[model samples]
Target: MLRLFAALPLPPEISRPLRKLQKDLVGARWRPEENFHVTLCFFGELRHTQARDLDELLGEIEAPAPTLSLEGAGWFGRREPTAVWARVRESDELRGLASACERAARRLSIPLERRPFTPHVTLAYCHATLLEDARAWTERHQAYSSEPWQAGAFHLYSSQKRDGGPSRYIAEADYPLSGFTAPEGMY
Candidate 1:
């Protein structure tokens, strides 16, 4: 079985600043810089044939690339505070791309969670983080925002789990957007 998802990788200008926010929090397992991405759709573990089908479906999706930016920080799991994240500013283009990913899964008869899409880049997983500490950390970084950049492409990524480390994500296939030309000093 292969663990898979479709996501947009971040450029250095956005990711490098996010790297600086990984400190001053206890019980937080920080995600590596390489793992920083905005997931469009997560298709859990699937048989090889199913995975291949999904990949082919993903490649056929055609849309203009979305311009995205990180704004502020937040956490999930209100009671226990299970994770920390940097919020992505919402855009219709982004949502349309995400919806397209879902439609692909539906066509393949793949079961998926019907959660409302909340665009964000997960920064860390909380093991035993205190609620107060989590709130404070988010408060401190609430005003953060990165320069917006247009995504050139999205990818079908395969994730590999490690025994005592963060899971490694590999981009198995690249799907270029319909109309994307990087502007000066952006990509």
Candidate 2:
């Protein structure tokens, strides 16, 4: 079995600013810069055959890349504060792509969590972080924003855990969107 998800990887231009916001917070395990992404759908653990079928279905999705930006910082778990994240500003195209991911899963007869999609790039996971401390961190970066950038592609990722460390996400497949041109200096 493999843990899989669909997500849009952040370009360097957007990630540079996010890296700056990773300090002065105690009890937070900051995520590595390379792990940052806006998840479209998480399919959790799946059998190898199921994963291959999902990958093929994902490749068949036809949609334009969404233009995205980060607007503000926030935290999940208001009481205990489980994670910190930079909110992704939503657009019609973004929602459509997310919906297409869900539709693909439905066609594969895969069950998904019923939670509504809240797009964000998680900055850290709170480990015994105080509620007050989490609130303060969000307030400090309330005005955080990133310049809009068009995503060239979204990917099917397989996550593997390393002993005593955060999970490493590996892109198993990439599906490029229509009309995307690689920005200069980016591959």
Candidate 3:
């Protein structure tokens, strides 16, 4: 079985700025630079053939590359914080890409958690008692903004846990946005 998800990888230009926001949060396990991405849809695990089929279907998507922007910061849990993330400015183009990915999951008969699509790049997972600290940190960095850039493509990634080491995420395939030049015809 293969564990996978679809995501938009952040360019170095954008990722550099985001790295600065990772500091000053106590009791938080910050994510690595290689793990930074805006997830479109998460498909936990699938059979080998199922993964191949999904990859084929995902490559057929043809949306224009959307210019993405970052704004503010927030935590996932309300009272007891569990995660800290940088918010993505919402756009119809972004939503369309996410919806298309969700549709692809459904077509593959993958059961997905039904919830409002909230797009954000998670920065860290925090201890539960740090709610106050998380909020204060959020407020301090509320005016944050990153230079907008075009999302040239989306990727399928596998999140693997290493023995006695941090979980590492690896990109398995890339599907370029319509109108973008696909390197070596990789779709």
Candidate 4:
């Protein structure tokens, strides 16, 4: 089985700033710069057949690359924060791409979260039961913003444990967006 997800990579223009947001907060597992990505959909632990089907189905989606800007910070849990991340500015393009990915996952019978799309690049995972004043932590980084970057492609990524260490995410395939002009010096 493979843990799979669809995501848009952050270009250096955006990631450079996001990397600096990592902190040594108590019980927090800060994500490395290489791990920063805006997840479109996560379909965890798929059988080999399911993985191939997903790969083939995702290839059918062709849309313009989403334009994105990173800003602010927030956590996911109500009483206890699970993860903290940089916020993504809302755009119809981003929404449309995400919706398409979600639809593909559903068509494959992959269960997915029903939560409304709240796009963010996670910075860290709080390992404790709760982090003191998670709100204050987010507030401190509220003014954060990264240089705007246009995604050239979306990727199918595999999340796996490495040498019994932290989970590592590696791209299995990259799907270029239709009619989406990649910026100069961009991947």
Model 3 lDDT per residue over 1-187, tens place: 8889999998877887888999998888888887889999988888889889899999989898988899999888877888899999989889999999989989989988776888899999887547789999899889999988789889999888989766888888999897655335345
Error of 1 at 56 (Å): 1.3
Provide the overall lDDT of each model, using Cα atoms, as 2-decimal numbers.
Answer: 0.93, 0.93, 0.88, 0.86
Provide the clashing-pair count of each candidate structure. 0, 0, 0, 0
Estimated TM-score per prediction?
0.96, 0.96, 0.92, 0.93
* Model 4 residue 29 distance off true place after TM-score fit, in angstroms: 0.6
What is the Å distance of residue 130 in model 2 from its true position? 1.6
Give the Å shift of residue 64 in candidate 3: 1.0
lDDT of 2 by residue, 1-187 (tens): 9999999999877987899999978899999999999999999899999999999999999999788999999998967999999999999899999999999999989999998999999999998999999999999999999999999899999999999989999999999998787778765
Error of 3 at 33 (Å): 0.9
Give the Å error, residue 142, model 1. 0.6
Model 3 alpha-carbon drift over 4 Å, by segment = 181-187
Error of 4 at 35 (Å): 0.6
- Which pairs clash in model 3? none
lDDT of 4 by residue, 60-102 (tens): 9978877789889998888778889999998988989899998
lDDT of 3: 0.88
Ranking by TM-score: 1, 2, 4, 3
